[model samples]
Target chain A: MTTSPQNSADSRLPLVIEKNLDRILDTWISELQVDGGRLLNLIRESELREQASRFLDLLRKAIKVAGVNPEKTAAYDELRDLLDELSRSRSEQGFTPTETATFVFSLKRPLFRELKEAHGDNDTTALLDDIWQATMLLDRLGLNTTEVFINTREAIIQRQQQDLLELSTPVVSLWNGILALPVIGTLDSERTQTVMESLLQKIVATGSDIAIIDITGVPAVDTLVAQHLLKTVTAARLMGAECIISGIRPQIAQTIVHLGVELGNVTTKGTLADAFALALKKKRQKVQDI
Target chain B: MYRIPILRVEEFLLVSIQTDLDDALAVKLQDDLTTAIATHHARGVIIDISGLEIVDSFIGRMLADISTMARIQDCHAIVVGMQPAVAITLVELGLSLSGVQTALHIDQGMRFLRRFLAGRDEEASDERE
Candidate 1:
């Protein structure tokens, strides 16, 4: 199978890829196993072999149909789809972006070796041209894998954040006519809305006259946090529930004064215990000293 | 055509809004409540809105207006049993109903009225003395 450069110049590339397809796949798998990264543990050996074989076959077909520039052609659509699915699943399976990207990058060595073996040493110019084209195609595909992987990871992170927002703002009834809302984590506008909604709902459900908003779990208090707290307090008051803001740490007190954010007529206490005591007082219920 | 029933309980007038009110009914309720406050010589008014789930700006303003009308007639108005969603809507609409006093339930509203009237009675007796 020795043909002149003119006979097999532009079209010989795809044929060469098809001819050494098996050797390239074998070399790629052996290299992945030898590298022995966390990819091996996250994915089973059989599964990895299946994906690797499918990827190589699709890639060879795409190159044959689309010539050296597979990425620009519609023929590579299936190949892109396969890679996108692989990256998304890898993200779901807890594989890092590096590992996902490495799956495509690892194909480079076997392909370069195949191109070298397909051409003789005298045809250095042809060998270089083939190597450059292969490099460009693989780089594009590798980048695509990374882009999809990052998107999947971002979606996962967003979902978890929403769940965390719901979980952190829970309102519990402390007594017959009193409710307590313990807020943890930073208070953003979105989270403040959740806090207000849950707190107000509990107040109405329990018919609680007094609400103690405990923020001991909140790490810091800025002007924005102060504003959020005030908004929640005002909403509760409008529902006929007097709001008592508790968990005012010493630092928070200083911060409040420094920010010049007035809490107005809303009552504030140093601790939840003190706030509960005040709520009872306002309810005209006396706690007999034991 | 639906008239919100205003029940007189001792020194306090009790009004429970159980259904969605149209513009005409809401205005009628205000007139009826104010008339009841005067006719019954009530010292306090308690409006139970627990059944009222949606309080648009129109309804919120009506509530505030009722409270103010009752107050001008020498009666303290307490809006009780306001749902969480209603309160949020009121606040978002920028109608705080600042003139109206609030309580969590009818019983609490009664207690608040009793305390308030008792304080007023003491002041009256002192003035008489």
Candidate 2:
């Protein structure tokens, strides 16, 4: 049987979706935050820049096949241009500015392994020094351990800052095209977006009826995190996923309770374990009812 | 990083932490100090904070917790290296740490611990008689 040209193109549609996922991630990092290097710097090394471009090409193709975006393809392109322009003048030194751009982009594989296995003194002082110094430099904060903690909160905030270009979500997973996300750390407007896209994609792909998120890792429940989390659950529901929340830390739980914001018919649990358990139970109940 | 203003010489353990005590690191400090103090029966603990610009509630609470925990184990905790702003912020956070000693410099905290240890040794000697 001969396959029509259109049918062949349609077969490659998954490939296109995979390419779009990379585009989405790139745009999200470039536009979502303002502080630190998130693809906002250039590798002054000509060879490395060439390498980055090839990497980008590979990523775009893979993302497109994943059915990566909803309405973000054009925006992703625009953000890439903006980031490319920003990095065009930067030197390739300073821990590979391109690799440090975002956790996903710069440290996806072998390079990350290189960082992990780099040798140091076989002592606690050396190991702690390495981790603390690296963390501080990456977050652009002061180095003080075992005493002053002024920089930790600042560093966390810097990591969580939101720009319009990136999603508000930090963690996204797709199982059989159903997206489930759990966002830890502080949520800014930008991360909230990444979360939404992940959830929506899962809804579309898996026809998912449930998404459970555990917020126990969040340091504090600021208005932005609360609002963003609320928005994501609502959006998921619209796409036909029942979003469940688990792992609300005591401090954050107090803050949310104090804020007196009604959670608008969303489910809550003590932890991600509980949330998933609830999801399984609900799914089972549905089967029984049927 | 705050410049080390106080260096303490102690008979058993030297406790000097030269960083701002934020919640995340404070947790680390709390763990480290508890171990160091126990292992050494550290008569002196010096915390330097001159490098800090701000101190939030979490860190403050952790400091208080560390101080109490150390004292319970018969180890004294001393706080040093506080910047002006950091000191002020902790005060405003409604956190008042009792029994946790603070000095303007690490040297002073050391001297206090040294003196306290000396006094304790003297009492032990007399009690042996």
The top-ranked prediction according to TM-score is 1
Docking class of 2: incorrect
DockQ of every candidate: 0.60, 0.01
Per-residue lDDT over A1-290 for candidate 2, one digit per residue giving the tens place of the 0 to 100 score: 33332232323333432445445344434332333343334333344444345544543453344322312455234434434433333322233343334432332332222223443334334334334333433232111110123233344456555442244353455333223466656767666566666555545445455677867656787776777777666444322346788888787778888988667667889977677667777665422443
- The local distance difference test score of each candidate is 0.85, 0.52
Which numbered prediction scores highest in DockQ against the true structure? 1
- Candidate 1 chain A has its poorest 10 consecutive residues by lDDT at A1-10
TM-score of chain B of each: 0.95, 0.76
- lDDT per residue for candidate 1 within A83-159, as digits (tens), equals 99999998898887888888988888888888788887878777877778778888999899999999998998999
lDDT score, residue A224, model 1?
Answer: 87
- Cα error of candidate 2 at position A171, Å: 4.9
Model 1, C-alpha of A142: deviation from truth (Å): 3.8
